[model samples]
Target chain A: MNDTFKKLFSPIQAEEALKDRTKEFLAEKTQRYIGVRVGKRKHCLYAAVCACLLLMLLGGRWVYFTPITAISIDINPSIEMGINRFGQVVSVDGFNEEGRELSSTLNVKYKNYTYAIEQILNDNNIAALLSENEIMTITVIGPDGQQSAKILSGVEACMTERGNAYCYFATSEEVAAAHESGLSCGKYRAFLELRLLDPDITPEMVRDMTMREIRELIDSLSDGGQIDTSSFDNRGNGHHGHGGGHGNRRRNGRAEQ
Target chain B: MRSEQETIRAIEQYSDTVRRLCAVHLKNDADTEDIFQTVFLKYVLSSVSFESDEHEKAWLIRVTINACKDLLKNFSRSHTVSLDTIIEQPSRLPEDYRDVWEAVFSLPQKYRDVVYLHYFEDYTAPQISRIIGKNVNTVYTLLNRSKQMLREKLGGGYEYE
Candidate 1:
């Protein structure tokens, strides 16, 4: 067996073949994520529109208005309609019941957090609707507890499925007016009557959760029961045997570097 | 700001070198490919800009080694393939060189990676050290230990000189 091994083992072009296979594998994997390009372009369009509106609204007063506008934009715009779930407004490609034009955009806000909504828009798949005349209905639930509704025109759409708070924005006449009045900018927007779909749990929360926790949560959901937490040590000192700790340390070290 | 196509081309150009480095360290095709893809993907996502081809190449090697270590951790029974199985697959290498290649493949993954980088990839100790994120002294020691292991595995038949 030893002699056979020695005889079979040689330095031929195995290295080159291995290299070629590696390249092919990488090429194939990269192509899967490359489709994000189209999404990115759409996001750029949304961002451009938002920036344009923001610029117009703040016109000649951008530097002075930016901070105030930033603060006024609500942190969490989502309404948790149920336990561990929330709702968001999505614009689908269809006509309203009245046959009047319908358009949509996501309205997401998460408490005590802010994200670059424009970047999020560019990362996901969103369809554009036709119809020169369309309107989006926004109902603002003010922080001080007053509710107001308005019709928004020239609305663009985007989506978000994760977070303790919603992360969405729109650029419409109503939204602009709300910002101008500075009364409705950061207020909650309810879409219950519009019958929008529930917002997806934010990726940030899922990402923040430990792998084991997520696995357990998924398992519990699958089995329809409370998860077993006895195995989970609050100190995070569970005996992972070999490799786990070392690997985590190395990964964390690299991330820090 | 560089286009994705430009980035892909640059990565493709160094694919072979990166693979060889990974193969040497991993001593098997499966692990090597995993490391190779990971390294390239990381490069694509990173905001760091490279000054030149040399800098890019160095970065690729470094990232490849780091990725290899990462794979070693998550490497479950399901993911690991025997080095013997990888060697037995008849593909490109000629029969005469098969012995040397097999011997290299049989070396422990750590030693194999260091030797491949130093000898096959033509990297000096300092460069290998940087790529592997180890000290220069450590790299030299690893190379020496790896050469001893290779010589022992090759037995009396092959001559390095």
Candidate 2:
């Protein structure tokens, strides 16, 4: 039966005309087959390019929003700006009641830190405070790195254009301790000096005091009509440069030419 | 889609096997042509990668069988075609071979594929099950019943192996 069946189907070959006709049908159906592969390759290429662009967009967004250094400006309002590596202010945080009000009114987020500082100083309320000899301390808080030094130098240049303001650079650890005490870096530095003179002074007592009031309190509590210059200058890993402020220059008498 | 050269190579390689499977299930030249074009056109458009020549041949066989079944099941083609013209060019066959062919096609439509794949194509029962998407026991039963039917129709002298 197997041989008989083999012999039966062996003679029934597909005709040559049938093969020719099938080839023609396939060529017409597939557009000679070349068009389909090219179309598929183009589709794959487009999808890959779109995926790469999406990844780059997300990566760029992450890079732009990540802050590497912090600048704390304390003039009783006590607002801090978080600066990215690109020197843009990515965040503005208020550390006190008046600071929240000032932070809310400022449209300085995502601007360069210099422009943001200029906007703050140009505000009518801050300008009035500076003219009244209210001490405005601009503190740049980060590691003792080039970026921090650069931001501190830029801030000192801005201070030179005004009066009754100081520029300082502090380490991240000192700023973290300041945050734990619920004080910005500038007021926290004053509170540390005051705590050395009179150990009973608390951060809450200093949180509501103006920097001028804190400085006067430090001078009044000291032993010989002067606060400890060591506490004023060398607290943690930080350094200060006094600008042209008549009240501060005569009071502390620590100015760097 | 496959390249033109690949499609042509596949057509030249598998056309005869596809034609034989179409003959097992189909009744006319027009239906055979439709299955031919449908099967090879699917090959041209399909992205399936075959591991070996045997795998490619099995795929074409399965596709041709299914295409023939689809054409036969259509409402317009469901009417019975005459059994005398079942095998194309039946006049060219010898009387003994014609008797065997007639007996094989007479064993009901369900058994025709197993009979052809088993006796002619020399496929094992398990291979037929995988190709036809049926249980191995079902394929064994169909092959047994088809052999018995052929034995009865063709007489006891011939071995229905």
Candidate 3:
């Protein structure tokens, strides 16, 4: 085996690629020590890029264990969360004013995902929005994808345990409302269901509509999913003659169905 | 810095050895070229003095192994190569030796290193231990494992050293 292996090893000497590239390969390997010339500059750049990329590749895994993490939620209130490896809150912020105010007050750095969100939403003013039946969306994200999904489910469970139907609501009602009214999961879908209740109501007006206004809309639709459109004149806007008000209004105006 | 004449002489004398060592271990054309260039560049720029030609050759072999290891660690994982990749448009190596070479390359890196150094480069297990930074016992164990693996891969027809 040894003699045969030695005979075979002779072919390892047959290098054809390095035959003509001797001068060029040497120029590349030693060009840094020699000097910087025009031709060598591109080689230098390529070398620098490769070095930096290798360093980044090595650093990428080490960075995963790093204690600091950031999570950005893109709901309308759009909160950005900076968290630590232990799931402690570093900071909570939002791009919008409402998100900023809610995140700033009742602030504690070391807290779990469930408690922090519960406290923030429990604020009197924030709770007032939900109690008054306004449409709001809260998305919870953590530092990375795995962490984000974990935090999302955690916060959703926390809200549900408190009997707060305000958050974590993707029941058949919302899904059915979405299907009937042609909307999806977020607040926009909720707005469509509200649209079926009152044709004259605009999005701007929907925001200011009290819980009573929303509840009446919900009550008007019996098990059949039909709205009584008769009470539209009594409370507010009275353009009630045509239930076809959906045709001209910008929201669902193009009733593509 | 060494003179240009010295650089040319070293390249002519040792480039083939360096290239061969790299090929036997790496089996990748691009990687073999890298080690080949790196060893020659070190010869050109190195300031260390050797007591004799034998000393210089040993030093070159050690550096070649170290450079190959460094390049390999930088990779996310080791990539395997078929013997056909090495014998592209082949000019030598009879079919019997070719099959053994393929079996050698397919062994895990640790075993392959000692086997290449022992059988191909004719380094003893103790010499391989010093060059590869492994213990003497470890080198022997690796060499044994390598022989068994190669025997299995090549259907146990070949004899061991």
Candidate 4:
């Protein structure tokens, strides 16, 4: 029966086949060590390629992370940031003009998210662009979801410390879907109305257009017999009635990135 | 430490045993593959030399077991392979013995390792202890306990030492 057990439970893969895969795996790892996998006929080429890869890896380690984790902030102002293991901001992709300005303003290459956000918010140009009243949504994303949650909490605390009540936090994939559906920006009544008014309107445009400007456009469009205003009361009606009241974020398909 | 051809040769000779160890010990295929790849990678890069091929094989078994334990310790608990995976596998085992085979798998991890090395790999208790970094007496105790548990689950029809 022990013989039966030996015959029965020896692993299923044949000796030759598994060895072939392990050989392939080892060959691939050589590339990590020497920058190129050793080749039989092209030894010189392999050496050159390995040298180049080694240099590139050593050189770029300071500038980038090979396996990166990033955050996408979607609200009316859109910003995406990539962080390295040291918590330095390595890449920043911002969509709004203010966000773009923020991208340029926040040139600190090696600061944690909290410090980076604090610096960006304090920059004269970026500070001038921020309206404490406007809701801001931050989404943390990375290869590791648990670490992303920790980053999201740290970022939310940073924002809260700055006296921003309208700040919200979410995961990257969730915010990505929200941005795709136009719900993230639409959470803002004025921006949602603007989006309803023109789907192509930019976040900068959303920020520039006042509630009065949006209401006038809707009223004009209503009077012109192009749109209906009573139904415009759908979601944006509250902004006009209680502009000062702090409203809980409505989910009617709105997302802040 | 060996040339690429020599490394590949060694990998070809020992890969199956290393992989079997991983599949038996790890929770899922992906983690198993990770340890599998990592073990070979370590072999290719390591400077250590052996007196004979048998020593090389023993080193790999020791390393594979350590790598698996390290990964398990550093990470959260892993999701093990499902019953469906075991049932669907195209194994050499006779249909009647597959359930008993899986029952051995259901043993506590330490017991499973002891039973697998003792019964399938044909290692003596002292050999198993040396490979797995445990006392020889402890290996025999676990092997006995594992056999008792398997008997209860699989019934007395399956013979045991």
Candidate whose lDDT is highest: 2
- Sorted on TM-score, best first, the list reads 2, 4, 3, 1
Q: Estimate each model's TM-score.
A: 0.40, 0.60, 0.42, 0.44
Q: What class would a CAPRI assessor give candidate 3's docking?
A: acceptable
TM-score between candidate 1 and the true structure: 0.40
Query: What is candidate 2's TM-score against the reference?
Result: 0.60
Q: Which residue ranges in model 1 land beyond 4 Å of their true spot?
A: A1-257, B1-4, B25-35, B78-84, B89-91, B156-161
lDDT of 1 by residue, A1-257 (tens): 23343333323232556445544655555564453465578799999999998887787454322221121212122111100011222211112111111112323332111222333223232111112111111122212211111111011112122211222233234445543432232232221101122233223332222223333344443444443344343422232121112111111102100
Highest-scoring model, DockQ = 2
What ranges in model 4 sit over 4 Å off?
A: A14-18, A32-257, B74-77, B80-83, B86-93
* Candidate 2 lDDT tens digits, A1-257: 78888889887788899999999999888778776777888899999999999989998988889888999999888999999999999999999998999999999999999999999999998898888878788888887899988888888777776766777778889889999999999889888977886777678877877787676666566524443344433332121223222333322212321
For model 1, how big is the CA root-mean-square deviation?
30.8
DockQ of each: 0.08, 0.51, 0.25, 0.23
What fraction of native interface contacts is shared by candidate 3?
Answer: 0.55
**lDDT, candidate 3, A78-191, per-residue tens:** 354555656666677544455566566657556765567667567787577556534334433223356645555565565553321333223334434433433223333435
> Cα lDDT for residue B141, model 1?
87
Q: Roughly what TM-score does model 4 have, to 2 decimal places?
A: 0.44
State interface RMSD in Å for all models: 7.5, 1.4, 3.4, 3.3
Model 2 complex DockQ against the native: 0.51
State the lDDT of candidate 2 residue by residue for B1-161, as single tens digits. Answer: 88889999998888888887877777788888999999998888788999999888888888888888888888677576765557654555566587877776667878998888888889999999999899999999999988788888888877776
- Tens-digit lDDT track of model 3 for B57-112: 77788798888888888655355655566665233557666566667767876777
